[model samples]
Structures are given as structure tokens and as C-alpha cells.
Target: MKRSYLLIALIILSACSDSADDSNREIDTVILNDLIQHSTEFEKKVYSFENGLHIAVGYGIANSIMVEGVDGNIIIDASDSVAEAEEVYSYFSTINSNPIKAIIYTHNHGDHTFGAAYYYNLEVEKPMVIAHESTSQYVERIMGILNPIISKRSTRMFGTDLPSEQVINVGIGPYLGVAQSPIGYIKPTLTFADELKINISGVEIELYHAPGETNDQLFVWLPNQKALMPGDNIYRTFPNLYTIRGTPHRDVKSWVKSLDQMRALKPEYLLPSHTKPLTGDAVMETLTIYRDAIQYVHDQTIRLMNEGYTADEISHLIELPTEVSNSPFVREFYGTIRWSVKSIFNGYLGWFDGNVSNLDPLPSEEYARRLVTLSGSEEKLFLALEEAVQEKDMQWALQLSDSLLALNYKIDSTNKLRQEAIQYIGGRSLNPNKRNYFLSSANELNRNYEAQPLLPQTSELLREISIDMFFEILSVRLNPKKAKGITQRVCFLFDSGETRTITMRNQIAEISSTNKNCDIQVKTSEQTLKESLAGVRNPVLSVASGEIDTGGQRTKFLSFLSNFTE
Candidate 1:
């Protein structure tokens, strides 16, 4: 009776302690928004230059340059949306009512190219859409492989998920999400290889393959006006050598070389896609410093990487010499030196940090459980985290929250604390993308908001790709584990009279254009097929709606369709 009473007393003490801890938990309301300086007010304004060269910067994420030739007009780098594009185009039309002779895409990035369709929609006699030969391929690749993932990250990176008060600017300008304009990516009509000097609307526009930002990046130079439009090659911020939102490897050497090439031109007027235009001495001076700064980081990163130094170590050691660091143009408002160092390091040496333990590690949940055990109990961990928050040690609080969240715990109090910690840290960040990511994550945890169901936007080029490419994309969607020991042959007969056969066996899918002995045959319109492949339409719904006809085995076809999801 005495031992049982002692145990009961211990349980009562523990319950009281738990209740006290919950009552004392407070959310950190310390506002740190004032830490970041907001510059560059976003507005729709046209900056006119000499020799009929006018650029509409600050209109959107991208700027449009209008080269008014003797007969017609030529525009480079269409603004992000239809409204922004039309606004700029209409402004130019008021100045010069000449038909748009040609539209040049500086790169395949959506912000640079999506507004092209607006030009066509305006009935400008279907102005020639010119771009690098690889632009279409890049667009197709993004739509097929990276769109869904990128779409989510972009919503976060641009702070579209956050409330207006919490979202500042996207480093360069205000977030462009407010503009309710749709994007219809127009296909390029004329594609060039390497370099092309073309006379459009009687303007001698020299297009050079100054590929740094994208493989398809091209800079426009007008010899007569002595104006240079470098697209995203020379943006305002310290170049996004590596974007926080995931991306394939960028050619750091090629980027440096591209800057050198631009410097060689020594143009009178330098207008980029993002920032204010520089002229006369400002152009050369800014370009020189930008090139040198980029070169310094690249060279230093490579040199340090040659040694046994890891990415994190190199980031701490290398600094952009005093002059480069102090440059107003190269300030890390968008991209920071630490991120660039890591990205450059990864470019040279892959993701391995030479830590043997990391090569094969336990799942995050298991590791987190071990950590909680080592730290004593979950309640103790929560108490320490609460104390950290009360002390305003956000970094420590964040670390503690990381442990709690590693087990995928979604309790209200813990998530609330984590949200506050992440938001505080994000407000202190100078890098725009980093701030967006941290704040976005915090917002996601705090709110159970649902994103509006919207159709996936695909470029006309994606729709025009070979049907075999579409099958190749579909083949990638098949879940390997789910398809084990499943062998199926399916044939598609489009209303356009094209027939394609697909055979799946042992986790491999083989696609062909010929008719084959198939267990199931699906007949659908070419438009429906395109829409379904682009993830804009549901295949199952199409079948139910009679847009798709399944012959032979409907159950087998539905089973095959079940393996793929949007």
C-alpha cells in the first residue's frame, strides 16, 4: 500500500508539471520585419532611351525592350503575364503604331517567354517568334519533369502562399502574383544556332549566345542604337548562381565567360531584365565589377574545392574581396555568397561531404526518436524549446523544433512555436528566396489552406512535341514497385488517326507507333490526349465522361491508369 501510494504521488506530480508547462507556453511575437531594407518600388513605368530604344522595366518580374525600327517594332523578352505584356505593348503602340515585326525570347524561362502569346492575341500579323533552338526543348523538359514540383516551390519562393502583410518583395520588386493574368506560352517560329544577326523591321539586331542564366540564353544588341539587353545575365542582385528553389547544375565558368563577352561589347546603354538601366561610364564600370566579382567567387570556389575543404567550410573561408563585396550592384539582396559557394562546390564535387556516416543513415523518424531519447523525454524537449522561445534564442528554438518535427509530429502547440521561430528567422534573412522559403514553410504549418484547383499551364511547344516523347514522359510516371510482376499491353487510338502501342513488363515500358496485340485499347481525341499528358485533365474522368472509349478490358485499363496520378 505504501509503494502504490508513492507511485500515485509521482504520477500526480508529473501531471501537474505537464499542465504548468502548457499554461506557460507563449508564442514569440517579436517582429523582425524592420531588419530587411526594402528598395526598388515596383511600378509600371516606361524608361525611354536615345535612338528609339525604350525599355519597360518594373512592369513585372521581366522587362520588355522595344526597338522601334523605321518600318515596325521588335520586342525582346516578353513580360510575365498577358496583362503586363499588353500594358507595355499598348504603351509602345501609343508611341509608335507600327506592327510588331518580330518577338525575341532571351531565354526559355517562363517569366521571359510566357507573354509571347499576348502579342499574337493582339493580332499583330503573327509576329515572328525567334529564340534559341533549344528553347522549346527546355520548356518541354520543365513541363514534363519539373512543372508539378516547381509549381509548388514557386508558390513558396514568390511568397504567394503568405498574407500580404508578411510578404515584402521578391528581392528585385514586389511579388507579381497580384496580377490576374493567364500565361499561354507561344511557340517560337524561328530558331537560331550559336549566333544570328537579323534585320527585323529594318533594325540590325545582333543576337549572341551569351548563355549563363540558361542554356538557351541569348543577348540582344542593336548596333545603331548601341543598346544592350542582356536578359537575366546581368540582373541587379548577386547572380543566383544557385537558386534555392531546386534546379539542374548551372555552368559557372560559362556564366563568367558570358559576362566577359558582354564587357567586351562596352555598349553605351545597358538594360537588363530586372534593374535600372546603366549608361555611359556606369555600364562599363558595373559590367567590369560584376564580371570580376563572379570570376572571383568561381575561381576561389574551385581553388578551395581542389583542397580537402567541404562546401560549408569553403563558404566560411571565401569572401568576395573588399571591393567586390562593397559594390552596390553585387549586394546579396537576392542571392547570398554562402549559397553560391555551396552551389559552386556541389557543381565541381557532387553531394558527398566525405562523411561516412551520411552515406547510409537511418530514416529521419528513427534518428529523431533516438535524439529525443538522448535528450531525455518529449515533454522535456518541449519545455526546453519553450524556454528557448521565451529567451528569444530563435536559432536554438528552430533546432529544437527541427528535432520535434523530424518525427513528423503535427501537434498544435509545437507547430505554433515552430511557425513563430521560422517566421522570425525568415524576416532576418537578406536573401529573398531564403526568406520566402522559411516564411512559406511556416505559413504552411500554421494554416490548413487549400490551393485552388487550376489547370497546369503548358507551352504550345510542349503540345507540339513528338507523341513518342509523350509516351516517354508517361513511362516515367509508372510506379516501379506497384508495377512489379504486372505485364500489360495497351494501345491508344487518337481521333487524329494516329495509333501508338505501349507494352509494360517487369517494371519497364516500351513504346512504339505500330499497332500491337493489346489487352486494352483506348480511343480518345488528340486534344484530350494532349490535355491528359500535360496533367491538365483527368484520364479516369475522360473515360467516365465518354471522351475516352476503352475497348476489350476496361478493368485492366483502369488498373493501368491507377499506377499514374497528378
Candidate 2:
């Protein structure tokens, strides 16, 4: 009789396993089908429009457009890398072999600006690089203070490290190609504050500073061609009001206003930095629905916030209306409604959710300890995690693993379980951003997983960055532990007639233009200093050769620099 009972229990367990597998398979089928259909939007080809304008789609994460002219052509938004840009230009050359007279950047995003060097170097005179007045400073910030964290998050968000089979698409494009070659960013020569109307290659182009997706975002209007190039503001996928890769709060109101500005022009051609271009009647229809979707989310979120709903609660409550949701342009391929709601909330009210309990919550580890006790014991908590996974309650299993991780109990086992849970959910996710982030997080849990290094910064790229920005970079990188109890002032005299000083006190590096009472003085050209700091040139050799002249003990100056090293 005991043998019969044991056999029955084993049979029941097997049946449950089969049921879960069937359910997962169904979810996977739907997700895979949707992603495959969406991938068609980025089919590699150059889309030629009326009036000598052609856009090369799927060459990289962003579209590179060429406007043919009488003597030369105008290039808008360079691809992602020199390699991708070269490939794109090869195709453009076939259509029109005219020299690239100018290159215009829609924003400061690497995908739009990094490939400009390829086009810039093609001409003897060099194409005039154009952008918003604030573009260069924004680019410096990304490459300077925020480089480390942004690079890591962007790598995961795009699934750049994932095997090809695991990645379907990056929503806006096929894949991110920034790592395929050296970053080829060139500083803009012509920058505008509000608007600039110029004739490039006999093409009457109008550029307006439209801040939406990025603070430096701009829209290009070709009055003669009846074409409007809305950089990243309007794409095929849902607008990333807040990207998972991390970004400053995207101003939703500004985004709506920008779209309305585009609609007012009533252009016949609509070309975006990412995805395919639209023409004729589709232009106004897409712009209207896209703007409506953004406004709806923003207004509804505000309404709920006023009703005392927390961000978490508001996220669950808000949903896109049927008309907006049905439109192909606003599908959650790049961004989702829930994440947007939370971001909108945080943007207005900051981190505090007006909840008393959340105002001063227990530390994570402490909370984990109490939760583990509530579960009877650490061992019981581990069992609960296992049971959650066994029951296919992946989200619960992931939460349980968090407690085990905080306690430092069975870390390897807990991570493995957490990895399995995330991978399962990721495999069935329709949104590529969420899917990639989840899978990338799972990959990170593996003991053998290696993170990719930051993109290589070439000497050419370093020349474009300003010396003042380098000092800002140094200030942020100052090691507080190493700087503790030390006070010193170091002054630098650059060949460009700029004097900057760094004063270290209270474990912080303060920067100023004052050059008086310097503890150590260094004299170097801006380029030489930039190269030395970037490791493109050897500092020891530079100092020994007098390229960098330290007015005092070399060892003392070198030691002071070491305090800023990570």
C-alpha cells in the first residue's frame, strides 16, 4: 500500500510538469511571432524618396540620410560607427557619388553622431558638422561623468552581449553597432540656439531646436522637398518616455509640443532617425496618434497622482486608450505604459511617493532578515524559493531569491534559481527592451559571464573633447578615500591660454579658474594633456620629453594624479 501511494505522488508531479511546459510554450510562440513581425520594419535597404532624398535604414541603430544636390550632397545623422558608416556610404555612393558637403546631427546620441567622422574625413575641406548649441556639452557628459554606468546599462538594454539567436531586435533597429569599430564622433562646427535656416547643397533646410527624446534633439524641415526629419521623437515603436538603459526624465510635455510643431508644418514626407519613413497621408495621421498617446499618458498620470495614487499604484491603473493602443506606431516595442507612468511620477514628485512607510524604510538587508524569520528560517525561505520556481511562479521566486542573496545564504544556489526565473519570463516577453534587460541580468548571474569594456577612445576622438571637460571628469573620479585628510591645489596652464586649478579639500575636488598659490604647477598643450589623461599618450614619456612640464618634483605631481584614478 505504501508503494502504491508513492507511485501515485510521482505520477501527479509528472502531470503538473507537463502542464507548465505547455503553458510556457504557448506564451513563447506568441512573443516570438510578434517580435519577428516587428523586425521587418528594419529590413536593410535604402529608401529613396521624391526630390533626391534617400535614407539608409538598418545599416545601424539609426538611419543615415543623404540629400543629393547640384554640386554635392548633404548627410544627416551618421550611422553608429565608422564600420557601419562606411557600409552605408558605400551604398549611398552607388546612388550619388557626389562628395558629402555637410553632415547634420539630429541630437547628441552616439548612434546619431559617432559615425560623422567617416563623412567628415571624406572631403578635403571637410563637411561642416551641424547640431544644437548644447550638443557638444551633452556628448562630453556621456563620455565623461556618466560613461561607466550608461555603457553597462546600454549594453544590457540592447542585448549587445547576447548570442544572435537570443536577440530578436533592439526595437528601433536590428542591433547596436557602436562596438563594431572605433567611435567616430566629430564635434559640430555650426550650432544653433533656437532655429537656423540655411541652404546646403542648394537644398533649403530649416532646423528647429525641438527638445524631446533628448535635450539637444532637433527636427529638420526641407521646405523645398516637403520633407520633415523628426530625429527620434516619432518612431515606429512606442516612444521611450523613459528608456530602461537609464536617461534623464524625458519631458513628456515637451515631446507633445514638438510633435504638434511637426504636425503644423503638414509635411508630405516623414523620415525618422530610426525605422522606416512615411509619405503622403500617413505622415499627419502618425504624428497625430503619436502625440495623442504621449499626452494621454501624461494627463492620466497627473490625474491619478492628484487622487493620491502612488507611482506603483498608478502604473497598474493607467492604460492606453483603444484607438491609440491599436495604432502600429505606439506599440510597446521600445517602451511600455507602466514604465512610462512610473517615470512621469518620479519626474514630477521626485523619488518620494508621499507614503509614510516608504519615507524611511528599513535597510534591504535588515528587511530580508525579518522576512526570512517570518518564513520560519533561512532554510525554509530557500525551500519557498524552490517551491515558487517549481510552481512556475517566477516573479515570486525572484523576490524570494533577493532575500537569500541579502542574507548571503547559499548565494550560488539562489542566483541560479533567480537566473532561471528571469530567463523564463524574458523568453516570453513581447517588448524587446524588457526582454533584453531580463536576459542580460540572467547572463550576469552566471559565474563565468564577463562584462565588456568601455568603447575604445581614439586620439582623434579625444581631440574633439575640451580640456575643461577633462578637469570635470577628473573631479568626479576623485577617490574620496584616497583624498581623505589631504589638502592641495594644482594649477594647469594650457597652450590655448586657459588657466584652471584644482583645489582638494573635504575629500572633494573643487575646480576653479584661479591660478594663485599653486602647490604644483604643470604646463602642457591641450592636445598633449588630453592624450596623456586618456592613456593615448604615455604621461611618463610626455613629462620626460618636456611635453608636460611639471615645475616641481615629478613624483609629487604623479602622486597627486593617482588620487583621481579608479
Candidate 3:
């Protein structure tokens, strides 16, 4: 309890250092090739091609997937990073003189797109960029929201924040012992909306925009050669019902449909966006198993929801049937079925535990303040939090501490104890999203402790995001039932005459606005959206910043939104 009071004092003096520095880190080019940065496959490059004109630049262990038949010699998902790009470039230099024709980006995901940017300089025409229309949007969205969080979370999860040697694999991902800088989000020069067919060096490539795990996704097919690369679709484990990084619910129906499409192909060679390549009849058999894994999760979760099961209950009760789990192709690496179930449930229905008592329930601090009168000391609250943390009780601790801190900012140990306790849990956590939250919470707390009084410009820069973002967050905080039928639409006008639209539906907020709106509506500002999406901006102050012009109805729109999850 004494420590708790002490942390409060420290937070008041140190809240200023909460700014996070997340600029793009430079890619190391020297040891790019020889270093495959050991993934699950963990093997050296394997090259084999049709007529020796094309080559399979293998990664992860087996040449899981290949970028063959570029006009002359270009890697599909060129060498893992910039460094890898250099080595792959060096190796190809010995074979082909076609100036590496072009990179056919299967999708918008960073793994497929980032490294290829290095190849543009080696060519004259800057290898014609191509992707699904949403691929461009997906790249923007991830770089905008997912990547930064994942990068920071990765640092903590992999102990990049701690000494590198001490970090051990929790057995989830392959990169368990590397401290690295964040990668840049490479923008695509060429984009496609739906279906596109291109002839690169006689390789008939077909790109279809299939919204499965990612909105901007593609599946390429070569009919003459009987080859198919299912970008991320067939790449990750299982059917990938959901992602660990918090995003919208992926369409399990669409995902299943895509696999069904793949099953129809029965191609001789199957290339995934990640992992190893699989061939022959087992490929078809394995894909069906993969398809079933996702289908079952989506179908069962829907079944449970229809049966009146809440999100948490469905998450706890749901499981892949015996048939799906028994298959080797249906493994849980980056994307887990449990989360896929949650994402599906969340998209269809907002989050509600199904208890009426939880409907507009009092904040933890409200209850805690009342408890203080009964318990008569800060020591009791301290003991309660201590018990919660010790019991591995995250939700309870978040609720209790939130209320406690809201009630008293004078406590000294709040930041330190919270950081220590949360870091301990986050370090050992298996779930990426849950682990990231704890780590971020600790980061915030540590920032409060490290700063002498208040956060500075960099931290405040994080504070300038849109209100629509807050409403989305509020939806996450509210009961799904309450979130039902809730819809908000607003336009914000920036001083620069730029406008952004904030729309929240299905518990997810999509913030985008066009400069050509009839009212010249400012959907959002560049800085504000960044701050809000990055968890840096304060929503209330964002409204007060005259940088936005909603025209006439913006205020009433704001009021309606303010009560969203409250």
C-alpha cells in the first residue's frame, strides 16, 4: 500500500515521458543473404525452376513458396528483408541479366511487399507495382495500426526490451532470440481492385482480390503451368479464421470459399505466402483439412452465438472438432483458432458477457472508493490488486487499477508496481494480443515513472487522433448488445481543407474521408488520425483543436458519439 501511494507520486512527476518513438528503422544490408534469420523451415536457399529460366527463392526451411518466371529474374516475395534482398540480388546476378523483371506482389501484407522495394533501384522502369485495390488499403491500415503495435509487442514478447541472450522461445513463433528494429511499410506503386491478369516472361499470372484473412488479399493462378500461389491464404496455418493483432472480423465464409476455389484447382505445385511449398495429392488433402479447420470454427462460433452464448463463453467452449485438429496442415502458428473464433463472434456481435448486471455497470474505482470507507485504508486496495496480479487475474487487475488510479493519482507505486506486475505476466504470456496489452500498459506506466511531470510533444503527438477512434474503443468497452444497431457518421475538416470520415459499425470504426465531399468534410486530419490510431491522442482535446471543421452538424455528431460506450 505504501508502494502504491509512492508510485502515484512518481506518476505525477513522470507522466511526460510516455511518448513512443516508432519511426522506420533502417534495414541492415551487409549480411542479408547468408542470413535467412531462421524461421520454422530454417534452411538455406533452394533453387529449381521450369527450363532453368525461373528459380525458387526458398525461405523458412523448405522453399515454402517460390517467385519463379519473373520477366527475367525478380523474386515474388523478394528475400525476407532489405539485407536478404541484396543477397538474393547477388545470387540472381550470376544467372539472369533481365534486370529482375518485376515483383508480382501477391497481396498487401508486409512480408510480401517490404523487401521488394529494394529491387526498384536495380531496374530502370521501377518494376511495375501491382496488387489488389484493397492491397494498397491493407498496407496502409497495417502500417497505420497493426505494424507499430506488433513491432512494440514483438520487442516485449521477444524480450527485445530486455537483454537479448536472456530471451527464450515461448514456443509460439520462430524468431525467439533476435533484437531488431521495426521495418518500414512500403507503399505500392501499382494496385488492382479485383481481378487482374499479367504476362510476365510468358508466365500467365492471375490476381484475384479475395477478402479472407486480409481485406487486400490475392490468389495467383498459372493455368498453363498448373501452379497456384494463395498469397497468405494457403500460407499460414489452419484456415486463419482470425489474427492475434486486433482487427476486424475476417470473413470465414469468404475464407472457406477461397479454399474451396483452391481445392477446385488441384494444381501440381502449391505455393503459400509463408511456410514451405507442398505438392501432389497430399496438397489437396491437406488443404481440405485446412479449410475444415476454419469452417468448423466459424460454423461453431455462429452456432454458439445462435445458441445464446456470449463472446467469452463461446471463446472458452469452442474447439476444432477431432477431424480438423488431427491434421498436420491445420497448425496454430501466427493465427490461432481461439482468436479466430473471437474475431468472428466479435464482428457479428459486439462484446457482451450476457449479464444484465454488466450492463452499464459501475467503474471499478466507484466500487473501490466505496470499499475504502468499509476497509478504512489504502492498504486494503493494495492488497486487492496484489492478489489479483498474483492470481494471474488480468481483467480484474485492469478493472481495479483503472478505477483506483482514476480515484487517486497521488499514489507512488501505481506505475512501478503495475509495470513490474504486468511485465511479468506479459513476458510469459502466449497470446500475442493479450501480451501486447500488458506490455503496452507497462510501457505507459514506465513512461509515467520516467517523466518528471507531464509527457512532451512526441507523447502529445500521440494525443491528436480522431473521435471516431475513441468511439470504436468505447464500443470495445461496451456490451455487444448495446453496440447493436449503433452507428455513427461524421466528417472532420482539417485546416488544410482536407476531410476525413469517421464511421463506426459492427463495433469497428473505419476512419476515412475524401477531400471532394460535397460539404468539403474533413473526415480526419493526418496528425489526429495517427495519434488516435496509435493510442497517443486524447479524443476530448482533439475536438477542441480548431484544426477540424465539421461544417454545421459536427457538434451534435460529437455529442451522440461521446455517449457511445459510456
What is candidate 1's lDDT per residue for 41-142, written digit by digit as tens?
345578887689888876777788888988888888888767778878888898887888888999987777777778876763788899999998887666
lDDT of 2 at 387: 95
User: 1-566 in candidate 3: lDDT tens per residue?
Assistant: 00122232232223222331222011111121111122334333544556332333333111223344655654565433444455556666666656656666776554565555467667776676666765655554444334446555444443334322222221222322111112322445567777888787666777777778677777877777777777777653455566543456678788888888877878777766555566678678877888888788888889998998877778889777887787756655346766777788878876665679777887777777887667676677667776876675755665556656867844656545566567655544434334444555576565433311111123332332233443344434444454467666655565556555556568565556533334224445666655643445665556556444445455764554554444
Give the per-residue lDDT digits (tens) of candidate 2, residues 1-566: 00112232232222122335656555566556777678788888899976999999988889999999889999999998988899999999999999998999999999998988899888898889999999999999888778888989988888887665567778999878898888899999999999999998788999999989998999999998889999999999889999989998999999999999999999999989999999999999999999999999999999999999999999999888999899999999998889999999999999999999999999889999999878789999999999998887999999999989999999989988898888877766788898888888888987889987546788899988988888988998999999999999999999888999999999999999999999999898989988898788988888888888898557788889889986
Candidate 2 lands at a TM-score of: 0.95
lDDT for each candidate structure: 0.74, 0.88, 0.54
Backbone-clash count (model 3): 42
Error of 1 at 312 (Å): 1.1
Ordered from best to worst TM-score, the candidate numbers read 2, 1, 3
Off by over 4 Å in 2: 1-23, 538-541
The candidate, 2 or 3, that scores higher on lDDT is: 2
Count of backbone collisions within predicted model 2? 0
